[model samples]
Target: MSSHDVHDEHLPAHRSETTPATEPIADPGLPAHQWRPTDVDPAAEKRAERQVATMFGLSAVCTVLFVVSYFVFEIGEVTTTIAGLGASTVALGTTLAGALLFIGIGIIQWARKLMSDHEIVEMRHPAASSDADRAETVAAFNTGLEESGIGRRPLVRNSLLGAIGVLALPVPVVLLRDLGPLPGDTLKSTIWEPDMRVVRDVTGTPIRPADLEVGDLVNAEPAALFETDEEGEPLVEGVELQVEKAKGAVILVRIEPDDITPGPGRDDWGVDGILCYSKICTHVGCPISLYERTTHHVLCPCHQSTFDLADAAKVVFGPAARPLPQLPLAVDSEGYLVAQRDFDEPVGPSFWERDSR
Candidate 1:
């Protein structure tokens, strides 16, 4: 006999005599199944199927409207507003939400009202199922497919398929517009023309060499933004002005003449001991102003990229691949600091077309 049979043979028959006898609990079987209205009545079943198909049809219609609104709405102009939201945003959001909502409702209704509802008991078993259990599982799946009625209910099946197919059309259409037009030479240059005064950022007052002392770091901007603001007709306005300001923003810092180390061909780029460099970080374009006066190091708070401003803003500590772009500086007849010309290279993050390292 097997080892299990041998172990059972050792058990004493007199053990039952010493043990107290107890009555075994009887099994309580599953409750009686109840038939749904749709299962009993053919008319109710037909009605449920139609309801499901209608939901899917509505989903397809909303998906079509979503595509329509994407092209019809003119962005940024804000021609119409509804309860503080733009009409374009309202239409696009509503239509897209409707499409997803209807599809979800249709699937739920299909399972509840028209699909199989028979109950079956699943007993506890080993973690690894037996071959017989696997066969039963396959059979149960096939039974579910039959009871779901996808073949019998042509209208519901066709509408659901069509709704899902049309939903994908909006993705490619949105992507085409989102790619936008080519950037051309816009990224390579800023509004920093020759003789453009380097003024204080918010105050817009021109910066004279005397305004800075050793170890002083001042945030500055191109004077062209505020010059026309005083004239009442700004040279750049709205989004254009915002874009120019971001690219043209700079930091003016003065170090001791003995501590300055100018890059090749940039010896005269500083006025007295004051040097100018782009305020935008080369790594992902985060604005950097956190400066350490003692080491002449500027740190980008977003990613901790450190640059030594006294040494041509070279990356000394973190993930930045290159040095900050330096602004060639000069002094006008009024003795105020000005740009000799635009930045020789791009100011912000590196891109596909530029050699950044």
Candidate 2:
């Protein structure tokens, strides 16, 4: 008896057991194939073929409509609407969805009702293929292509081809004009000049050294966001205010004075235990400042990129290729915390022109 059989023999009669190796297992062949209506009925086959072709034709119509709608409506015109959404948005979205959805349905119906219905059986084999196996695979691929009858059905084939060709036309049509003009030198600078007060992001109240405690992390922006000029006109408003706040976003963290390891020529960058760094991640421009007070490490939520805030915000883990840029800080004559100047390096994800290590 085999080892497994011997082991089974030692078990009690009450134990659950399987058959012995000495007995042979019979093979059960596949069930008989069932024919579909489209397979045996000539009328049904023609009907299915027409259905798939009709779907493909509709897809082509939707794509053509999408292209037409692109030029039909003005972007910001408030006069027209479909259920409160812009007429342009509703038209573009519905047509594009229909274009993709109809093509997908057409392909699925064609495969199910018109393509080859033979059920294939493949035996388990070693991963490495022999020369004969490769030749047989190529022969089977050619056989499948012939069985699909794509060459015989001119209506379905031509409609599908036309739909696919028209689908790609919308890409360049929207990409060329949808996005506004280039950002030109706007990203290279911020409104944070020398002596600009660092204010709370939402409250817009200026911060002092006394306002922060050890292990405190605060989100801040430049005072120019909320302040007014001599004539009482806002310093910045609307899109300009938004752009400046996005570029000047910063995080102020207070660590133990003894824990800081400042970079060269940056010894006086902090006051007491307070230090400031950009709130943007270096990897992909995600906003950061998820702080671990014990380790003084801030994490980017998007990609989990970690930066050691105590040591010039140097990246310690994750996909970030560089450290968070440090913003120099000082106290104004009014005892409010202020920026010594704009960040020495650009603050955000690395770009082609920024090669700083």
Best by TM-score: 1
Which candidate number would show the highest lDDT if scored against the true structure? 1
lDDT (Cα atoms) of all candidates against the true structure: 0.89, 0.88
Candidate 2: tens digits of C-alpha lDDT, residues 1-357: 899999988888757566556866677777889998999999999999889988988998998888888888666534467798888889989998999999999999999999979888898878999998999899999998899899988888998998898887774667566774333455567788999999999999999999999989999999989998999998898768877888899999999999999987899999998999989898888999799999999999999999999999998999998898888899989999999988877777876667533
Candidate 1's C-alpha runs over 4 A off are: 1-54, 75-78, 81-85, 120-186, 229-237
Clashes in model 1: which pairs? none
Candidate 2 ranges beyond 4 A from true positions: 1-61, 64-85, 101-144, 153-159, 168-191, 213-215, 227-247, 255-259, 264-268, 284-287, 290-295, 301-304, 349-357
Instruction: Give lDDT for model 1.
Output: 0.89
TM-score of each: 0.71, 0.60
Root-mean-square deviation of every model: 10.1, 11.8
lDDT (C-alpha) at residue 126 in model 2: 82
